[model samples]
Target: MRVTEDGRGLQGSVAPTPPLQAVVWATGYGPAFDWIQVPVFDAAGEPRHQRGLTEAPGLAFLGLPWLHTRSSALMGGAGPDARYVVEALLKRT
Candidate 1:
């Protein structure tokens, strides 16, 4: 695979490889959380959630940008958001 001249895209050929062993994708943040799929996201690829509670049930995401406030992505904010998610999880149980 090679990157486009613009460096904003990938151009490659998909060919068969040996049988599955494991696959590792390292997409370190930046609106590219493609690994999290299904009903968890809306049409815009943003998580379908309220606060930290995701639509996938039981599963939740904490510390995402603007999760509940401008500081939601901060370390300090994770504690509070985690508490909220824990409460929500308890309620669901």
Candidate 2:
């Protein structure tokens, strides 16, 4: 289904079969690490790193677009990156 341009409701060829009781709209926007006490952002304010791996020791990132793959920001993408970061951290210890 497609959301109305005004965002009041969904606009589609067919109505929902079960009828619509509630709708949750999730939107995507740029990341804002303003509160982070780290120097990981670039001039554009995005993270300065390679595939979510920052140069800061013991610092790593996840759930970022193209972090490990094209789906890095998605649900399944965090697992592998998380594991890799964890292993690296363990090795440091």
Model 2 misplaced regions, further than 4 Å: 1-30
Candidate 1: segments with Cα more than 4 A from true spot: 1-32
| Reference-based lDDT, each prediction | 0.59, 0.58
Relative to the true structure, candidate 2 has a C-alpha RMSD (angstroms) of 14.2
Q: What RMSD does each model have against the real structure?
A: 10.7, 14.2
The lDDT leader among the candidates is 1
lDDT value, residue 4 of candidate 1: 35
lDDT of 2 at 5: 56
TM-score of model 1 vs. true structure? 0.60
Model 2, residue 60: distance off in Å is 1.0
